[model samples]
Target: MAHYRASESKREQFRRYLEKSGVLDTLTSILVALYEEPDKPNNALDFIKLHLGAAGPDPADVEALRTEISELQQKCEALTEENNELKNKLMQCEPAPEEKPAE
Candidate 1:
């Protein structure tokens, strides 16, 4: 019983270490990209080799920002369309009475 517990603990520790070692994040795509493009900007090691930190626009981060910008632009377009639709509906609706109601 104690032996199994010890083995389980060791396995758990190994699993955690493996996860931290990036078996979890699975950089397979990044590695493949690096293999395809040696000069590629955001390979796992490229950042460290280039001493990238506290500086602007890491390549990976820029790609993420571009994705975010695209999402925001879509949202803005959708909102604008919705706003125009609401305005058109408002224009079609009957207007409120100009005169005050009797007190």
Candidate 2:
């Protein structure tokens, strides 16, 4: 009997904590939005996880970012090659000055 009462008290405290934190309201709102979706998700848990940002970024956005990064990397490589080529040409054009012997 004592254990049962303690468990109930703990549950009530947890419920109050959830209410105070607004977690109950946020969860209710998300669930309500999911309920209203016309084309409901096959996996309700996945939908909730996605909405909660636990599923990472959208695939299309990730792909777009990857393409942009790849293009930038190529551009950077080309610029580096061009810079090295220019430096080599400059070095070839300007001969090193003769070193003087110590007196």
**Each model's TM-score, in the order given?**
0.40, 0.69
After superposition of all CA atoms, the RMSD between model 1 and the true structure is 11.1
lDDT of each: 0.76, 0.95
lDDT of 1 at 3: 100
Off-target runs (Cα >4 Å) in candidate 1 are 1-55, 96-103
lDDT per residue (tens digit) for residues 13-80 in model 2:
99999999999998999899999999999999999988777888889999999999999999999999
Which residue segments of model 2 deviate by more than 4 Å? 58-71, 91-103
Give the least accurate 10-residue stretch of model 2, judged by summed lDDT. 49-58
lDDT (10s digit) by residue, model 1, range 9-67:
99999989988898645555445545676575744575443443434567899999999
* Clashing pairs in model 1, backbone N/Cα/C closer than 3 A: none
Alpha-carbon deviation at 86 in model 2, angstroms = 1.2
